[model samples]
Target: MNLPATYEYYAVIPHRTQPAVLLLHTENGWSLPCWQTTERHFWQTCDHINQTIQDLLALRVITLRCLFINQDTGSGHFIRVYEFENRDAQWRPPVNGSWIGFSEFKTLPLTHQMQRAVLEAWFTEQMEGIPTTRRAWARTGWFDETARWIVEILQGQAIEVSEAVQQVRTWERSCLLRVATTYGQVYCKAVPAMFAHELPLTQHLDVHWPSHAPSVLAVNRQQSLLLLRNFGGPKLGERGIFAWWEEAVHTFAMLQRETVTHADSLIAMGCPTRTLDDLIEDIRALLADTETLFVGGKGLTNSEIAALRPHLSHFLNLCQELKTYQIPYALEHGDFGPANVAWVEQRPLFFDWSDSSVAHPFFSLCLFPEEMEISFPDTSDWQMRQRSAYLRPWVCYESLERLTRAFEIAQRLAPLHHASRYHRFILPHMEAKWEMTLMIPAYLRCLL
Candidate 1:
């Protein structure tokens, strides 16, 4: 499918003593280095920007932060401003672009009025030397404070910070940075208010299951930051070995079973409780919102939406039936797949608990079988084996036949789980809502 074009203007700035911005001279005038692409999401846009800058200017930079977003619905043109960092202190000017000082940049003729305004706002903020209230990591001072903390924490552990901290990823939800140390690498993760539970939840996991999760070195609850020892391994399924896949399912099932009694603790730690009854109410509300179900011409058609309305009764019946078996609720990793699992020392250690909740454990298996099939197509019985591995720990609660029936019911209703999650938790907190446009409707259509 062809996506709408999004024009991105990057303000490349060096994070050093002298403040400057990179600009390229065009026939019209000078402007921040810009590019146009069809990629809409922040991560994909960051990838495209990095590659384009490398190819065009032979320079490497890291995404500092998002400066602004202009989403003009009438014109159907979206503009995004991103700040990128050139970490080198002795960097030279590129062949076609020059690093203009902040004072001199004011006098240059910019190609667009919008660019000039954006640069002026940035310059004003830089000159005032005021810390940003939002996303403090975008500023250079954040790195310095973080580096000192890292040294303080590693002092008694016989480890030292060996190199500069490198940013791994940044977006609306979270930012990840990696620090190279004498022993190995450690990661620092920061999240916003919506995902504040991730810090405590990860610490809980490390305390309860030290062998299966990363070690937490330090935590700042006020800032929602976690310093963790790197759990080194390739992502699950990267090796193409079916044994790892089977083991991941089995181990995850064991973890879920063990945590069933800790549901209250998990909820106390801020994990949202999404019971079968709660899911039913969410589904009813979603079906009633006609506007969102059919928004943006890309969602379900009129006929499909009509067909979906009558099936609400069927969906509710499925949820009610699954609740009858009395399967105890546990921690449901909201976004479970091979990508979230890491293979460490021949075991599966799950990470990225930003989407976690306390709900029906079977709901977690909604997408695992489908993903396994895609990864190992040659293995005909992989899905069956995976189900058996996951359900084995739950056999103490119900017969294998009855558990299989419950699994089927959960699978049929899983789309509602995902749609409700996006509607309630994910989309509302995002700045670039268009990046996830129609996600709720797309998941709702899976019910058909």
Candidate 2:
């Protein structure tokens, strides 16, 4: 696939207390303060914009909320508009930019038609206040309120807020903020309503396995926010140490084994129950919904869907056969992979519980082996060794041979499992469904 050559970012730097935006005098005309880069994703665009403003304008800014995205297909010129907050309100003025009032901006000539359109949309959004179509953090004043709340929480814990809060990452699913305090740096995470369970789930893990999870300092249940102490470690496989993969799988399996007896409580605490029987019914519904299964051009073709239909009975029988092994259901991290694991003090810290559920434990490793193979293609039988490490914790329930067979069965049905999850839990709550347009069909295609 050919990547876009350049991405032009427009920063809507709103005044601290007025309805005005910072505009720069460019060769074309007066326009919103802009930066250009080769980065594709909005988060990376935000990062580059922030760095450029800091270097040239000697001002610190945070780009948390995105207003618009457009791509010129002919030129491959990607345009992104983001709302930026100036951290240091008292700063030197830029040589070419000045704060232009909302009414005054309309009288000036813009760089192009697209710039005018973006500014008009932004001004309309400002007049309308916050919209329901986007996450709460994307609105004006959300960062200030959240930062104040963080300061209050940390101060109550005897830690003084020392530095400005910085944006770590923000996307459709969640927003991560880094807070610097006298004690150390802590992270504040805010999730949408769809994944509200993450807050309580992380707290539960912290209470049960403090050594393997980040410490939850405070929580705002109403906002689905969590403040976590820094784990002070690098991500698993960050340095390309392959042995960490085996250790991570072993640790994750032990967590599943330990949580087996708490399945009911976990479900009651908002963890979705994805039993094999439930998954089978979900698959049936998916196959019947031709409209959703064949929506996008990239979706499964008629021939592929026909081929997958015949496997329904085989999938049902596989689910039934696995039940004979009598392996108890437990906590399954729906999106488990090396990226979600942090290696701290010789132990693996597993986080990001937004996709967690109570289901077949073996289902957790369905994609693990494939991910490992892709990351370490030169290592022979690495998948087998990792599977062994994870399965050893379950030897008490069934023999290694029986457990391996159950794992295979779960792998065959994993695609349907993930497809059902997106169709049910994720898509409906998403404000921008286009971001995940291909996820369900992509997963379902694995069945063919």
Candidate 3:
């Protein structure tokens, strides 16, 4: 049979295919691997695949190498081929599938092509590339519910979802979904019940600052759902800082300046306030915490945290000195990155506000040069450029010396959060955390 010109089809041939029928050995036969499909991206299709191979199949794979991947745009089907090789002698497949070889599998009622697709995807060593997913196979838990929720929201719409999937970064605590419909595509975001505030917060921004944010199409604050019309822009690249960063940061600075009057609206929505004033109390609380530091912090039972208790006053003094800079605080994006942005035409949109809080503007810089440089090695001094650009507007508001001091202080204090996390210069072993032993006085002596 000739495959359609619109779609391509390929086979996932095993390394050496004398294929096998992977019986689920269940009373009912819902465990067939044929359920696997393109919707799985990297075959993280169902939660059972991993456990079935490990616990049920009793096989430990040495590698899941990708043999090849061929696609047919005409049929909208991608044939991802692969093989799973066992290198250990102790590994043995379950007895239930003992007779699942290609010869035995053909005896089943399934057509030849259907049977082959199952064997190829199951035993493949590994897919060459796996798309990003949050909490591996989240569909196993809340996916069905999420689908129903979307369907219920769009029940009256004159469109059908051709495809839908959720992509989330391992570090993020939110779900970003992409849904392709007969008409076009739309995006959806799901946050925790506590973070449902994002629903109203985003909608408010969309109304008041639509140029910088995506408009909400539908929402269910109770479920923490926020649906947005896809802005139809390519996502910013993962590696390297680009001109978009400058534009976004500039827009952020502008937003923060204008939003100060609207702070009540945001604060009511649960954004945290951690300005320098707040830091004063936060520091004193930590000084108070020194009495119990070892009980809470990691690696502290080693006697190092105990030695730093006497220096609490010194740290407190530095915290007090930070007030002298008088740099104004503003809305801070706790975990900003390129992935959170999408451009609509020439306009750049900053999103993924899950970690946002109210803090010193420079506090946002914590993730810039340091964390961003890690992701984009070629990022160079993009942080410095952004820092200057972000601070440029506030130039007439404060002296350069004070702003510089505030920026430096934010560098040291930006990471201060939670009593349980390891704090630098508060312990003798702090050197191990940031290698600050030699430069300890350089960072902290000014406070003394």
Best candidate, TM-score-wise? 2
Task: Kindly state the number of residue pairs that clash in model 3.
Answer: 16
Q: Give candidate 1 regions above 4 Å deviation.
A: 1-9, 12-22, 34-62, 66-81, 85-133, 138-140, 298-303
lDDT of 2 by residue, 1-448 (tens): 8975798877778877777788889888998777787866654334556778788677788776666777677888887777777668687457888888778888999986777777887788778875576888766567778988998899899999888887777667887888788878999999998888888889989999898888999999998899999988888757567888899999899999999988888888888888888887887888887767777655778887788888878888887887788799898888887778899999999999999999888887766787788888899989689879988999999999988888888888887888888888898888767566578888777666
The Cα error of candidate 3 at residue 216, in Å, is 1.9
C-alpha RMSD for every candidate: 5.5, 3.7, 14.3
Task: Name the TM-score of candidate 1.
Answer: 0.80
Instruction: For residue 262, give model 3's deviation from the true position in Å.
Output: 1.2
Ranking of all predicted structures according to lDDT, beginning with the best and ending with the worst: 2, 1, 3
Candidate closer to the true structure by lDDT (higher is better), 2 or 3: 2
List where candidate 2 sits over 4 angstroms from the true fold.
Answer: 1-5, 14-25, 38-48, 54-61, 68-79, 85-129, 288-313
lDDT value, candidate 2, whole model: 0.82
In candidate 1, residue 374 scores what lDDT?
Answer: 89
Tens digits of lDDT, candidate 3, 45-98: 212333334453455432222333444556666654323333234544445434
Question: What's the lDDT for all of these models?
Answer: 0.80, 0.82, 0.52
Displacement of the residue 290 alpha carbon in candidate 3, Å:
8.9
